[model samples]
Target: MTTKINRHLTWQRMCACMATCAMAIVVACPIAGFASVQTASADDTANTVSTIIVRDGMLSRYTQLGGAQGILRQPLENEHPTANGGAEQRFQGGTLFWNPSLRGSYLVRDGMLSRYTQLGGPAGRLGLPCADELAVPGGASQVFQGGTLFWNPSLRGAYLVRDGMLSKYAAARYEQGPYGLPVSDEYAWNGGARQDFQYGSMFWNVSDWWKYSSQGPYPNLAGVSNLNVAVSIASQRVYIRDGERVLYTMITSTGINDWTPRGTYRINGRGPSFYNRNEAMGARNWVRFIGNFLFHSVPIDSSGNYIVSEAWKLGQPASHGCIRLTVADSQWFYNAIPDGTLVSIW
Candidate 1:
């Protein structure tokens, strides 16, 4: 009886020892067996996990954003080091960028991503994306460390604005301001840079920046029976009309004290340029609506130099007897209006 009891006690001790040894093995390498389990359970969002873990890196963000079920989809490649001690990784849905200076990762995908890559990716002018893509008034945009990427249907793809041009755009209210979304990326022009927007193009040089309204070419107003020009002396504006339908409006400067005749007339002869030595001023692209009265550009000197002081008087009564327009608008008028077009001054 005593021998049998001692053998039973020894068997119990061996079982307890085996159980402790198994526990020690598991504690020593806690993550060793987790990959397979996570892979099998990845379909479930709550249970989805990243097999690879890196502090403040792509893998950690992937798991946090819902792993396989997240918008990032599945990991296509392992996390890799980037320039400046940063890290990045590619996934099925998009690429993840992890900046050491920033807390987490940013995702850039679809058209925005393609444009970013074209602009030089992380090594390019745009650098790494600082934030995810965001919806704007007309289209979508994503912020990068160096600049912002813009995408819309009208743009055909994505474009970016950076540096001084970007500052000018922001001041102008971005896409919501006078200029709409960027239609073209910044490009070298002369010794400076230029970027085109929906309504205008912004130019930047070493010292200053300026904008030009891109009215483009005049539309074909053919076969319209009631095409006419209405000049408003009170509002300092010229309204182009097809019957009562207002097709376009242009800013103009007329004579002070109503020197411009307020009577019905017809557009007659046209000339490229004229200089009045008596007035010591000149103008270009004149379309004569009446004798000694015409539609012409803002006053220039006899040497064909723009009179800055006179040009500044646009949108008010500043001309002597002719209707003064911007050089661009006057040129457009000279090209678009033909002989026998009706003109009414009021």
Candidate 2:
């Protein structure tokens, strides 16, 4: 009618420009895929938040930034990229970390909390140094020589070293004792007091009055009786034993130190006495044993020569502290030690 209505208005303006170019390619393909999925979901919600409260709330709201007064908004803070990125902060105010399975690396700074390690990567080095100062107290047990702190006086516990020594739960807790005796190959007598013997090489056996019964291993004779007989300040050289056989061979001289007085006294009195040098000492012949001390013999040196000598000082520790023997070794130590014998002295 007007050409067919202007050709139906150009054909409806080409069909409304082809429906506005198909709605501009369907809204630019979803706004460029929703702006690349909203920029990858806001970079994954800023990497899942907490980088130590986002670096302490961005250094407490940027006291300054680009100019660098407070700096670090995110140079790095609690990173941990896969398992190796390593980071966990608090910096100028304590707590810092790295620890990729103890490949180690930490820092707390002025409030103390140091640690470092890395010599080969994958976290492998650090045999020492790296806390950047403040070591002092013998510089960490001298770079781990004292082995990183210890006290263990037999597991009273308090140890912590690593790789160098002690750390199997502190050497398995503790249980130590028996350190005094052990050297027996079987002579079976056990008696103990460090196998007692008064004078060197070992010998003790005496009976009759100045008692101390048995002990003898003389010059390696090894007749082993465990030992415990000691007397020398003149209790008449008694050391005796003729039964179990151990004998240091000698006896007879007692009583004179102001009439016998020096503490330990025994052997009350035995038989056979006669030569009497004012009762004994010099040939009381055979006065088996007696107390207040006496097994006599005196005048050993102005040489009136009354022989039977092992001569332990001739004024002989001055008698009454008696033990002077020689009359046939005091009749074989009163016929070989008997009555309750056990003597000890300083």
Candidate 3:
């Protein structure tokens, strides 16, 4: 009876050892369906050590993006709460903001990351990035919840435009338009807001928005008007047109210091000759368009002798504040251009 009882005890011990070994094997082998291990941290204790499992969602995304070796480098923080209950994790290269309901996580990095943060990150008008940055023709671009951000190699960095400003930009064909890409965020100016672009700026007020092109201030004809005079400061040329038809083109000189005002003005007065004692010079066939501003011939001396050197400055900027035309051109202008004709200078 004693032998039989000893044998029974040995068998029970063997069965218990087998069950323990099986459990250990199950734990050691990784589960096939679960995400691969991303990162592990350990907590030290006197009698036990516990492992923190960092996996799934964001972790999975991080792993796919090359993790420690990718542009994002290493994770700087564990996943944390953000606006709208979303989660975000900071990395050496950039940041990953995750919104599970919105499908998945998206990355914002480099110059774009800085700009996004400046605009208030996910809490700002831009919200979260909807997708990864895309390679555009000239640079890169990324779309967001509220609007889009664009980057160009030729520009200082990335910039964003949204709401009404974005609509205006789109209407002008974005980068292809006269404005090109945005150079600045919408900022307060005068009484409203202003957003600058590559070529021009857009101003906003309580009632409406308008574009101020850097090329020059042009009046909105809507349809062609009867007569308008346009001046090109850069080209140093004057265009006299009738409802879009080129009536005449004349070489001219503008303010050397860019003192000539840029805008649409009316021909308010005309004179046969006038002299500025302060400037010690005079001109003939003068037409006043605005305050102390005029279109006249090259400078003449008190002896009424044409200053040959001043006339040589045609097709360039050399005047104090007036538009200088040639002797014959000014003569024709004084006689032909009537009062109330619009003059646009840039």
Give the Å error, residue 86, model 3.
1.2
The candidate scoring highest on lDDT is 1
The 10 consecutive residues of candidate 2 with the worst lDDT sum are 25-34
Report the candidate with higher lDDT, 1 versus 3: 1
Task: Please provide, for model 2 over 68-101, each residue's C-alpha lDDT reduced to its tens digit, 9 standing for 90 to 100.
Answer: 2233222223333222445444433443444445
Per-candidate clashes come to 0, 34, 0
Please give, for residues 1-346, the per-residue lDDT of candidate 1 as tens digits: 1121111222223222221231121111112223222222324332232243233356567667785568876455567877656678887688899876776698889999888888778888878778889999999889888998889776579989889999988987788765668888888875798887664566787222211213334456887679899898876777678987756666678998889999999999999999999999989889999998999988889789888788767667988879988777788889888888889898
Q: What is the full ranking by TM-score, best candidate first?
A: 1, 3, 2
Where is model 1 poorest over a 10-residue stretch in terms of lDDT?
22-31
The residue pairs that clash in candidate 3, if any, are none
RMSD of each: 12.8, 29.0, 18.4
TM-score per prediction, in order, is 0.59, 0.17, 0.46
Output candidate 2 Cα RMSD: 29.0
**C-alpha lDDT of residue 71 in model 3:** 80
After aligning candidate 3 to the native by TM-score, how far in Å is the CA of 155 from where it should be? 4.3
lDDT of 3 by residue, 97-210 (tens): 886667688899988888899989888888878888887656678888889898866765888888888887788677765455677777886678778765456666622221
Over all chains combined, what TM-score does candidate 1 have? 0.59
Q: Candidates sorted by lDDT, descending order?
A: 1, 3, 2
Clashing pairs in 1: none
